[model samples]
Target: MSYLTLFLTAFAAATLLPAYSEILLGTLASQDYPLFWLWFWATAGNTLGSVVNGIIGRQVDRFKDRRWFPVSETQLHKARNRFNRYGQWSLLLGWLPIGGDALTLVGGIMRVPWLNFVILVAIGKGLRYAFVIWVVLKAGAMAT
Candidate 1:
């Protein structure tokens, strides 16, 4: 289903990996997919992926020895401090690459309330999908 594809793409994109969710969204939109379902699926998938990052961040101590990540405890502490104070504003630009997932994990590390994090993340994710849908729909409308 188109929703499945969108969800998968969005999920992968939200993780620490490269994915083309925007392309998938554009293709689905061009094919006249059910907008609401498509939007819901994408937002849910992306948000879940971000949550995974949060889970990992909560256990950040385990990864403190890793060379690849290289994020020191002191730095993480500083980040968490800043994150806890400005979590909502951080969610506002969740569409930006890299920052989105990082913010999510940092939020968990900063002990952001679960409900507030999810709600703000949903709003940000919803707007992202809506923008994608609007752009694809507009392009299709102009083409036709």
Candidate 2:
């Protein structure tokens, strides 16, 4: 049940839901759940969630003229320019809540080499979960 909750929460957060998966993961990790399963589930859920984001982002080209799409190619390319300027290394920090998924979604919009995007996104999101695990274990409140 806990794993399922974690998976769903992380998955939703990765999508544009404005949820905080790291907070959820931190809460769970503080509980001292099996480390392996916890990280595995979180990483799997986050990666799959990002893939969904990429898929949704791919649809943006079809609606580039819409104002409510949240992320359009015009905006995406501008972001891509930033990413390109910063180099793919920016994806490492892609796990940061502020501009994380935006990078991934923009990567999809820019048609970033598919393999590169997947590799970078997985690494970025993976490290984010790892960091959350570290935080929950190190300082997050323990679950009762």
Candidate 3:
């Protein structure tokens, strides 16, 4: 049940949702739940959520011209330009905060290859979880 909760939390966090899964991940890691599984589930959930964002990005282009559209033309253009300048490697930064989610969305809008998107997203998110877990464990050791 705890693992499931963490997985769901991570998934939601990866989406445009404002939730933060790292807190839960740190709590669970400190509790001594298997670190490998915790990291795996969190990365999997987060990556899947990003995929959803990409899918939404792909569909949103149709509605993007509307005045009330969530993402303005300027924002979208900037994201596109950044992605172009940085190339697919920019996807590696998808684990970041505000900018991370935007990059995933831009990838979809730009029709980035799904294979590259998944691989890079998974790697980035996985490394993030790994770092979080490491920090939690290190802190625990220090408190002893």
Against the reference, the lDDT scores of all candidates come to 0.78, 0.75, 0.91
* C-alpha TM-score for every candidate: 0.86, 0.81, 0.95
lDDT of 1: 0.78
Model 2: per-residue lDDT, tens digit, 31-67?
Answer: 7689778888887787778777777767787987777
Any runs in candidate 1 off by more than 4 Å, and if so which? 65-69
- Give candidate 2's TM-score: 0.81
Q: Model 1, 7-126: lDDT tens per residue?
A: 888988878889978888777777757888888898898888777776777778777778887698688878877776765568655667767888877766665667777777778888
Measured by TM-score, the strongest candidate is 3
Ranking of all predicted structures according to TM-score, beginning with the best and ending with the worst: 3, 1, 2
**Residue 16, model 1, lDDT:** 86
Deviation of model 3 at 64, angstroms: 1.4
Q: Which lDDT tens digits does candidate 3 get at residues 61-143?
A: 79988888877788878888888998878888999987899889888988889999999999999999999999999999999
Q: Which residue pairs collide in model 2, if any? A: none
Clashes of 3: 0
